[model samples]
Target chain A: MVRIQDLPRKNFLMPGNAACPGCPETMGLRYVGMALGENAVLVIPASCSSVIQGIYPRSGIGMPILNIVFAAAAAAASGLKAALEIRGLKDAQVVAWAGDGGTGDIGFQALSGAAERNEDIIYICVDNEAYMNTGIQRSSLTPYGAWTTTTWTGKKEHKKDVPLTLIAHRVPYVATASVGFPTDFIDKLRKASKIRGFKYIHLHAPCPVGWRFDPAKTAEVAKLAVQTGLWILYEYENGKFRISPLSRPYRDKSKRKPLVEYIRLQGRFRHLKKSDIAVLEKYVDEMWEFYTKLEEIYK
Target chain B: MEEDHLVLPLSRPAPGAMGKTGTWRNYKPVIDQGKCIKCLLCWLYCPEATIIRHEDNSVSVDYEYCKGCGICANECPVKAIEMVPEVQGGA
Candidate 1:
């Protein structure tokens, strides 16, 4: 029950950076700063965030951030945490923030190793679903039937279930959050901060430029992602699974919005034919079914 | 190896690090003070962190660095913020 007014007024992200006008990465980073405060060190890999922090000799963000190569964010974070402990800075938190390309594809091995070892770090994968900074290349997290520069028609493979993969490792905490629901995201961040061991938060951020939507519609697009069942918000902690309140209503099949409503808003899915949309709809159902089974088994 | 003598390639944190991004905006957001409920939703959603939340809980836009993305106007629950086109060269 985090209220809007109760949020900290201290902004970690400064006024002007290199992000686009209505970039979703910045939208999420604002809350990330609010929730984590000044004690965290962010390790960013090659992604939009790397550029968003601005050029050398001056950083756009207020806190300490280590910009690393494409496949080393988690590895760097693990080392950073160990170094902080050696310096007797036990209270400091090390956060690894990377895009989908870095998390699901490029840096998956490092991330997996860190998770398996139960590293004391918070790994946040801001999944915008593609290599957007590199001009819209496809990543494993890219949803099926969405067009990228490489996938001229549409991506044939469904999105990778990275959260489920993390769950298999039985980490201390794992949650899926959306930029549309900032308070829910904030609550998740706070909860993760309090917990020890590996924590992974998958933040669904819709890209206005790469996703081909109006800049002003960033929040709306994110909200639609949840309402349509394209993205489910939930948290898994200490061998327990529960759906977040914002998305609980959509668990009822009748309450969920049509998948087409979510797809029609983005130009990347404009080329999706009726048959392709049916495939997407089926995919969403399968995902929901898998989650429901997990809940039942865990319960 | 004294810390002071260690020449590290460090970048200090600075505001407007990418220059005054307000210049990139084609549209400027105008807040209608009367309609503002002081919810600070605009400040929360702003990507550039240009919206200023005051001590009294009232809000104002820092035009110097605001990119005028219209997100404030769009996310305004009461339509308190309006996006006005920037008139260049005294129109």
Candidate 2:
């Protein structure tokens, strides 16, 4: 339970940037900056961050950022880490920050290779659930029954479990965090910094414009996702898996809020009918069941 | 050989890189000092990093850079902040 006053005062994600009002990317990046401080270099791919970083001639973010291509963020970070080591700058952390489209789809190969080789770089996948940078196109991580520009009738496939995929790589650390819980995210970033090898933090950032929700409800919507048991916050470190303290109470089915409370808030889930809600709820239950089994095995 | 040298356009790090995004907002958040608890939750969640958390634990909104997202007002547990229209002359 880190206090607000206890957090670092340095603002790495400076104001007057290109980020939209109530953008979750900015919120998450704020925590990342507070945790890592001045000793970090971000590897950003072709995503909203590339634009939010502001156009050439002036940059918004305080940290050094290496803007790479769509599918080369993780690979670039790995090489950057090697370069830093050779230059006697081992303390400088190289972070690969990418969107779901770049991480789950295009950059998955590079990310997996780095994870397999156990590269010492922090790879953060800011999952906004779709290709939000280039309008709302459905991506591999987009949940089922969610409306997107490409999926007008709602996506037919379920959201890809990227964290679990990373965990299978037996990485040193893998955590799921949300923009709603800034303290939890900040704590996780600090923890990841201490560990060596591939550290993957899947940050759930709800996009207001793409999700068709009120800009102010960004935090509210993210909170509902976790409260409804739709998005589980947990960490996998060195083969030991456990739910985060914030989400521990939600393990009990009775304690969890109804899935509709989370879904109805977003216009993207408006197309979901009663039957669709039921399916989504069942999917949530299955996900919980998987987590419970995982805890039993590893905890 | 001198003509073959590659010269690239570069952007320097600076605050207000987008140039006073405060102009983009239609509504701005106004904090009621009496109701404020000095919780600094608004400061924690501000996307623009425009909310200044002073040394005394008091929080103030820097309207010059704040895009007026209403997130500060929305997330305020004490309901100390309110969103007001920027242009008072408009209906």
Candidate 3:
């Protein structure tokens, strides 16, 4: 286990930020910031992060943050990176931090362009599973049967395979991390900072207000997500697939926690029916099987 | 390679049982006695009934099943209950 005392003492974020009581995105930023330090340029879109950082002259981030439109984060980060290189500043790492709505939905075109071209920048999607900044609305990345403002009854579609979609571009690196596992997240950021091509980190951030969960249970929900196999952590390095070790045995239907355990904590999924949970469980099982197969075939 | 496959364990503990600590929602509640007026608001609001009533009528929060919603603190008329940050509780 990674100890907080052994980590660097430099603090990149200040208190009094605008994030809700248990915003997991802040933890994600804390880990990434520790890994990259002051030599990093962050590009954020108009999302929860933008609000969290507050207006200019009162921003929470100690490092430089460039605020841009929702759909232009990736493209803008690429431009900033190239500009830095042209100015003979190749040491600084350029990073794009965006929300699920920005990366998985609106900014996908720009992200695809940058990844296809193998731009030298890190693009992180801090996914709370929906367009939370605007409202608790459904986005392309919202999981199946999840409740959202847009999906009042519950989402009918499965979350888009965002990591796989990026891997299709054959980028140098792509991985998934969560604030619940800070050491893993920090390690991924350190690795991404050293890599020289397009890199993507899909971070699972829990939004307490948006999810209607108790502020204190955010990390618990994040851990449940991975333990339930509803959110698997994997990375594709140069077309090679590597999954995090199964922290425990596979959770088959008979042994799995009731889907309601994962759903009831968040008010968003309060409207889901028993049949909806069953459908979601089936999908989770199928996805888990598919991922295990990938590991076996690739090995 | 075939022999190596045999080295792997045949089965492991159930996923939910392996950690035993259910989801990350496990939290302990704290009460600020200095701010408390012995109003018993926390005792009445505790969903798990984990609050203990002392002979003096003072309330003590139990950590075993407390979800730590801070509702008790918010609802406390005397501002006595406070949500103490657990080491690994929040996101």
Candidate 4:
């Protein structure tokens, strides 16, 4: 029972790093690091995350980070795990942290290969919904109707369902988490660390700079994301779907915030029109309805 | 003196829209009518289309549709609108 207020105050990552203010990726990394503790080796890719950790000799995180190429994070982590097994040193947890671009786009092949092999490692994709490190370019995870450098008019396609993609692989554990829900995220990380086979954690990390939102509202924005049904918090364990109770439908419509509010808070979606917003709302409704049906069927 | 008015077209809400409805719990967008160029940017970008127009053509938030996401406040060009906390019901 990690009390939100009583969470350990020890700071593993130092300040003055490159991360923008109220960066969701930084928060997720911090909590995940805390959950895994010092007995972990992080395999990073060429994304905003790599910069957040800083360069060697002055890294932000306390653990040993193995910075790999843009698309080989999953493969590198698997290799490290195999090497550790060969050395008979299986005590430490090996984690591969990648951005949405690295995981959903360029790195998808390597990641799918690792999961298909059931490699023993934990993989977390800090999805800011776009390629933030390389200047707000659009990725497969960028939600439709949202603006980005690549999609100044708004992304025409819907966000790719990465969790369900992993579920197709039928891995041992796959969970969706957000820094907005720290306890839930930490719990998932802890559980993922202990699991033997491939585990996947998809975190919706808010990017203040890329999203063009205030730094202080990072957590608040993420909370609204889940509350609005734009981002669902759930897990699939051994082919069974366990939708987090936090994702319960908005029975009291009054209590449910509009998806527009969530969209407006971020600068990325500033240019959306009435028709665009309508399309996004419909997409959100359809996705939420689909997720609910999945929950009912699996329940 | 008449104020310079910027009338941003507000999207009319459809009947039977599904959204969180309360007395506008999370955000309360306060318009400083004095500074309002009446640009209506708040009305245009409202995700919920919660802004209501009076017969006199003044704009206000329809708490029924407002989710308090604060995009209106952020996009207000003249800083005429401020997002204050709703006195009741926010997570």
Candidate 4 lDDT over residue span A1-299, tens digit each: 46544444444444434454445675676676568777778899999877765433355555677889998999999999999889998788999999999999999999999999999999999998988877889999999987888998889999999988998898999999987777888888888877789999999888777888876477778888988877889988866787786766553335567988898888888888989888987887787778778767766
Q: Rank the candidates by lDDT, best first.
A: 2, 1, 4, 3
Steric clash pairs (candidate 4): A253-B20, A253-B21, A254-B20, A254-B21, A256-B20, A260-B47, B6-B39
What is the per-residue lDDT of model 2 for residues A3-25, given as tens digits with 9 covering 90 to 100? Answer: 87799998888789999999999
Interface RMSD measured for model 2: 1.2
Q: All candidates' TM-scores?
A: 0.97, 0.97, 0.76, 0.74
Q: Can you tell me which runs of candidate 3 are displaced by over 4 Å?
A: A1-3, A246-248, A251-258, B1-91
Q: Give the Å error, residue A290, model 3.
A: 1.2
**How well does candidate 3 score on lDDT at residue A277?**
83
Please give the fraction of native interface contacts (Cα pairs under 8 Å between A and B) kept by each candidate: 0.79, 0.81, 0.02, 0.00
| Residue A224 Cα positional deviation in candidate 1, in Å, after optimal superposition | 0.7
Give the Å error, residue A19, model 1: 0.5
Error of 2 at A243 (Å): 0.7
lDDT at A39, model 2: 90
What level of docking quality does candidate 4 show?
incorrect
Better of 2 and 4 by lDDT: 2
| Residue-level lDDT for B52 in candidate 2 | 90
